[model samples]
Target: MHQVHVVGLGVDHRDITPTASRLIDSAEVLAGGDRLLALFNDHPAVKILIKSPLKNVIDRINQEMQSHRKVVVLADGDPLFFGIGKRLIDAFGKDAVIIYPNVTTLQVAASKLKIPWHDIKSISLHGRKDIQPLLTALVGNNRVAVFTEPDFSPAKVADELIRRGADTFNMHVFEDLETETEKTRCFELKDAVKQTFSPLNFIILNRIKQAVISLSLGLDDDLYLHQRGLITKREIRVAGLSSLEIEPHHTLWDLGAGCGSVAIEASLLAYEGIVLAVEKAPERIQLIRQNISRMCAYGVEVIHGEMPECLESLPDPHRVFIGGGMGKDNSVLEAATERLRPGGKLVLHLVLMGSMARARDYLKDLKWPFSITQLQVSRSKDLAGDHRLEALNPVFIISAKKPALRL
Candidate 1:
């Protein structure tokens, strides 16, 4: 009959606005979570408790609407924001529902902390076990807010962040916001992982001032922990990374990721994306982990496995860097190119002329347009009282992009 009114009650019954209170008072049918429905125990309206298997709740609302003139659904915070209001709007046509908004829990959390949230990244872990997006956001953003779920609780989130070598953040947990039991506490990531919090909570992660890493592309080779000359040279890495054309949210693969230099640098560039570094050597894998922590590149993941084989299990890439498999077979290159997303870029670094020839022929056969650059870098070395330039080995850098449409 009449349009259903969905009201957002901030934290409790005390948060109901005058208009929401009037609507609830006159409602012939009221529906909400048990906690929300219980707040209006004195109301004479027929109350329906919102439950899981949400279809049942939708069914009840549909049935009640046939007999009632006024049906009101109660929601927490802003109804449209990760709330049931969207479900109602989708179930009924947009014209059949009217939504009344209120400040969201995230807004309150930010307000309580006196932090400006316009630029903060907000993620909802409710009913989601995937932590990748959260981790990605945490890597690139200085501030983030997360809505917690039972399975992916605040402590669990903290654990995941710490496990990924993210320790430079200060975590703020707001529990029972705006309610009698409201409690807010802030802790370092290490301490946050050890403490349990109320299920009704949100977490705020603010990166520490000193934890910010430089945005420059090529960091000094000496800054990373690597075996004797096993790392990608700074100039070569800079040239290769530039060719990769990394975007902020592009998933990248660093095959033969020696000390994860390319992946770590790409992670900084693609902070909102994931960089999978597949390295075969266990020693190098450890080194990659250490370098990732050193660079604060939380978005880079070090996979302790060989290339071509490890490529299958990874998410399809928007870009790939073949830095370590130069002298090896061309199968890794082929696999990486095939898995690249449409319009994706692939960059390869080769020290051997034969390897470069093989890669060039492979790209030619695939009909992929490509470019090659030879990098010859000379660095100044302190010798006795004079500085002499020492030439590093020349590297061949090849880059190609997968055509967006099949030829």
Candidate 2:
């Protein structure tokens, strides 16, 4: 039969059966990672598998199947659990393939640790969205399992989770699941910072919820998504929402879309107004996408790269929110304010002393019809089982109009 077979292998070649070994040895071509391919070292003509350049491998597989040659593709743990088998079946179709099962590492991990596998909430965060959604699903006291990648490995996840103030969950990490050198590491959610982990590791988190910082106002500053160390305060966020002036068919620009607060809110406001949230960081770009999706702000479009460069292709603006120029030198706010049609509103926030000065002089030069505001916010806190008050940093705001900017 002209077909492809995807075979799963155990941690070691010794675990493979004679029939599977024979299929590997007699295959016309082999495709997989360096280690997986090396498992069949005796077969000298194995073709290497490269994921990004996927079409090349597909082309070879197609050619082999057309020639009626037997092809065996190798995969790790389970071919169906975050493995390549499903992609093969999807690409080549079910009628053209057969899958030989092997024990997935999770089974081995559970067996080795004597724990139940079905109870753990298994997720692959390799290229999945950040742990925010995963965090939201967390129960007060529960367990979570995650598969890791080189970039978003176990350590990185723990660091991010802790930063987001995940001091409520306990973590259990296991590495090299079924190998001779396998390892498992455990820690409480708050004590996670006490240790780090290896690159190849899986995570299990036990819920460890912290005290509610007055619920509504204290969105757990750690929970809001932002870049390298930048975020919008809830107070400023509420204010920006006020000035968005969103309406049906309105198109808004959230320049320096820190945590996508304005964009998400504008999307909520305009429901029909379009919000373009712009940011320069790759992580924050992804974060904005996740936040928009999480809030189901489908009307909001998350653009990658920097604002002006990223925004060059977007249609004209109806309203713009400048949240980052607080300290930026080559500011996109200038372009946004300039492009704002007659009567269109351009709302801006400046944080740095010098940036505020620069903004004052620049706005004065424009001499547009505008209104300026400064906010000194005080947030309530709890101390000694009583409510206390505290203040966040001060901010300067300006809302200008180009006088017929549009509906």
Candidate 2 per-residue lDDT, tens place, 1-407, comes to 57888888975546877787788878888888777776667777657574656677777788878888778888876788878778878888888877877877667666656778887776676555455335444422256667777777665676766554455567777876656877887776556555656665677765555433222322444655566557778778778667757675777888888777677666555544457778777778778766544443444566777556677777678898888765446457667776766677888887777877777677778887777788898988999999888987888887777766346
Considering summed lDDT, which 10 consecutive residues are worst modelled in model 2?
210-219
Off by over 4 Å in 1: 1-6, 23-75, 79-99, 111-120, 140-142, 212-215, 381-388, 405-407
C-alpha RMSD by candidate, in order = 4.2, 11.2
Instruction: Give the worst 10-residue stretch by lDDT in candidate 1.
Output: 208-217
Q: List clash counts for every candidate, in order.
A: 0, 15
Question: Cα lDDT of model 2 overall?
Answer: 0.69
Per-model TM-score on C-alpha atoms: 0.81, 0.52
Candidate 1 has an lDDT of: 0.85
